[model samples]
Target: MPEFTMSEKIYREEVHFTGRVQGVGFRYATLQVAKEFEVTGEVKNLPDGRVYLCAEGAEREVVAFREELEDRMSPFIRESEIKSDFRPSSYKSFEITR
Candidate 1:
């Protein structure tokens, strides 16, 4: 097997996940996932119980993050919407907002 590396392009994205996001470890799970992708940002629960996430990382990682949310984690989430754009930040890791 040959080892290869792909350059990562960083971008910022916001995810809004609705339904059952609270009291189900959604934020914690999101933090774990973010760490896996080496993403840096924050996740929090909105007053209306929606999960809000701000993440910045490689494009591929961001996509994987969203996919994991939609597939392996969709059962925990009723619905989700994602918005992405090019933005740079100096954060090194993700966190669960208070």
Candidate 2:
């Protein structure tokens, strides 16, 4: 039998969403998606009509989070700019940054 091993890399992504992001529950929706996949990080509204996210979790889970945001988030989302990186961090929970 073969044993399963988890990926050693921790995925982190910062998403910059444009168009009708604010005043439309964007942050709230992001929080839900992150929690669904057990991702840990922070999400906040940027001053430049965009949303920022710093997510840290298992590689697969983080990838899922990005997909969900683009595919299943609120209708307010028009376009998204995503930046992904691989690193290590200790994130216990997800949060909505102010």
Candidate 3:
């Protein structure tokens, strides 16, 4: 039998989504998607007409969270920019920020 091992890296991602990403429940939708993953972070509407999402967790989990969120909100996202790191962040829960 093989045993599963969790990733030692705590990956963090800061994603900025553009095009129709605001004024359309983007933040709320992001919050809903975050609940489906182990990642903890926040999503908010940027003043420059973009949606900002910051998520951190196990490497795979964090990546999966971004993938799922992108898939779920593809229609509203015309483009996206992502910055990733193998660092840890403190976020007690996922949320939609003002």
- TM-score on alpha carbons, each prediction: 0.82, 0.81, 0.87
Candidate 2 CA-lDDT value = 0.80
Winning candidate number (TM-score): 3
Clashes of each: 0, 0, 0
Model 1 stretches with alpha carbons more than 4 Å out = 1-9
User: Which whole-number lDDT from 0 to 100 does residue 4 have in model 3?
Assistant: 31
Off by over 4 Å in 3: 1-9
Best to worst by lDDT, what's the order?
Answer: 3, 2, 1
Give the runs in model 2 whose Cα sits over 4 Å from its true position. Answer: 1-9
Highest lDDT scorer: 3
lDDT value, residue 75 of candidate 3: 92
The better candidate by lDDT, 1 or 2, is: 2
Which of the two candidates, 2 or 3, achieves a greater TM-score against the reference?
3
lDDT of each: 0.79, 0.80, 0.85
Report model 1's TM-score to 2 decimal places. Answer: 0.82
* 17: Cα error in model 2, Å: 0.9
- Expressed as tens digits, the lDDT of each residue in 1-98 for candidate 1 is 54433333358788999887799888888887876786788999999879998888877787888787667677778878889876546467789987
Where is the poorest 10-residue window by lDDT in model 2? 1-10
Instruction: For candidate 1, give the lDDT.
Output: 0.79
Error (Å) of candidate 2 at residue 33 is 1.5
